[model samples]
Target: CWLQQALRATDNPVIDAAVRLGNVLGLPVLVYHGVREDYPYASDRLHHFILGASRDLAAGCRARGLACVQHVDRSGHRERGLVYRLGADAAALVLEDQPTFVARWQTERVAERIEIPVYAVNGACLVPPAVLGEGIGGRSGFLRRHEPGRAAWTVADDESTDIAPYDGTLPFVPDTLEGDLDALIAELDIDHSLPASAAFPAGRAAAETRLMRLIQDVLPGYATTRNDATRREGASGLSPYLHFGVLGPREVMRAVEKAAVGARHSIKFADELLGWREWFHYQARALAKPEQYDRVAGWARATLADHAGDPRSHLESLTAMLRGETRDESWNACQRQFLRFGWMHNNLRMYWGKRIIAMTPDPETAWATACYLNDRLSLDGRDPATYGNIAAMFGGSPGDTDRPVYGRLATRSDGSTRSRDGGAAWLAKAAS
Candidate 1:
């Protein structure tokens, strides 16, 4: 079993499916996870989080009587064609059914080149995108199909492997991530500028802590406080963990269902977590290219094109935007969250994404800039939800009259974050 994003050992569809197949074939499962220095935005922050989760992954697999190996791509530890070499020994290969980013492209290439039968399992979502089928149009239509199926898919039956761990490996030696991972990551040839996030720690323990926080603190008042950017405990702050598969939706929802909270708050949390997030996953699965500029609505593109020449002011350089030094304090406050903690408030994301249109040279540049900043800085970048939310910001209901740079596409205000008590002070402090 090859895991790219689904890093957890328990309640993971990828690992569970692999174990089932292994049991059927009477062969032990050899789990492999590799980190390369060449993938886009390979920095200390991403590397540290991934390696921390992977270290725990190996330990977890061992506890379950399964073998898990890891390889970190660096100067001396370069192992070319590792996946191909490993596939040579296995009867079949099982990988995560990821739709976007490196995992999707890598798994597709491996399946084409490898001789053994390769199977992809949907591990990222609670209700698999495949189960929903295609051509579901909008979120309401998606919910009609999705909500009905949720009860059946919420439980995860972890498969047990009857066979012993795989001890026969002829490829290169694997890196041991058990101790002093920081020293090893520091020696690697990755971006040292972007440091590890203190807010969202790596490994299963940290993931569980967030889950506890979600049930105890965030869920009770989620309906009212989720939109407030001023409160530190407003949002669950679990997106990074969810994106990396440290905590699957099944496990999170299981906890949420059992938590002692009001129905209104729990239902609202479920809407954002499963309803909105999975809808984006389904939307991205249907698109030919989810990350492209052409994915925006046709009407939105036309209106923006008509008003492309109407821009006269408020253009910030890429460096200023990247460093969170932009003149717009509200946008800067949003960007700084990505810069400092590799995450952002859900409410502020809308304002930050929409404002990029006027802050850049053109509409295409605006889209590219928003994607680059989000994908590069935030831990949850290069995801279906990330692009889907950005696309919604770029293309929504047409306004009564066309505007300057935004045109028919509606414009968002900073009042969502700025109108609250001490909101102005928070923005000023966050921007600095």
Candidate 2:
């Protein structure tokens, strides 16, 4: 969620320097990124399929009359300017996603360094975060007044969305992914120990298939069974789709509402999740220091200092938990599902996240590791909701401040009641 780490990790000083040059030229330079991880070598998943550059934004940019330049530099068809290269008109800067906190700062700094006006586009959401922010006023104020009014805000379709129709002349094309993706996966230099699950496919077709299936078959069960992790089709398997922006929330909500018009229960749950998304964003924005990871008001230095030495052991424990080898069968089963699929049910994710913080040394390490791994893997990584979930473990979450035993600094668990023997037997059968 934070981009500072990535900026430091970047090898491309040219991106910084060139953008600065563009700014000095009075051009509205749009910095485009496919993968959150910057530059040359990146996991294929990291690189997004571009429109003129990314799949959708190119058409959107051209429709808005922004000149689409494939500024790869060496291709010198025109007078290529530096990082500060600026456009004559307002440029529609299309980023792969919202810049991480570090990326956001660096982007602004680059804008300052280049002397251009940048409108940070909310490309991640079908409806941008800013639009959502506008709808929900300042964080604390919005939630206090509107938390109860969630039904109204979400029930209304985001009327402002406009994905410009694609024109053939656009400079970008969808990445023609070739060969075996599995073989490609092995080459990414990621941890090979974690196996990829076949349950979800890795492209647009896969995303649509899952969504279509859910609308037809699974949504009917959503009202009652969505929370039950054991029922594989219980909940809307739309998290990964929503996370990847493969299916827009408005589109999904509208489709579900249209199809399940008589089924108010499903409509209510879908609305609730969207509202939860708004709720999380409001909480994240409202925090006094949203960028400060792992440290809460009273629980910062002592908590970090207390758990510095044995991170390796903590890592091992977390890895074991991730692998579904822990003592809790219910948690282990959820872990197995996440291990096999890129997601877990929302109900299970809370249980899974709570357990991780409980076993790890400090809240920060636990939160960082969980978030990092999930972001790298889950289709929905790098989302506000995901960030908010990790945030919940620290002191208090969005809707409530009640410190749950899991994220709070404490050692408490009842072996028999929370035991997963029942779940373990089910998971073992499923794994086999």
Q: For all candidates, what are the clash counts?
A: 0, 29
lDDT of 1 at 185: 90
Question: lDDT by residue for model 1 over 198-284, one digit each (tens)?
Answer: 988999999999999999999999998999989977999999999999999999999999999999999998999899999999988
Per-model TM values vs. the true structure: 0.99, 0.63
lDDT of each: 0.92, 0.47
lDDT of 2: 0.47
How does residue 103 of candidate 2 score in lDDT? 40
TM-score for candidate 1, please give it.
Answer: 0.99
Tens-digit lDDT track for model 2 on 234-286? 67776665554445555566566667534766655555555566556455544
User: Model 2 off-target regions past 4 Å?
Assistant: 1-33, 36-110, 123-197, 261-263, 286-319, 394-424, 429-432
Q: Clashes in candidate 2: how many? A: 29
Off by over 4 Å in 1: none
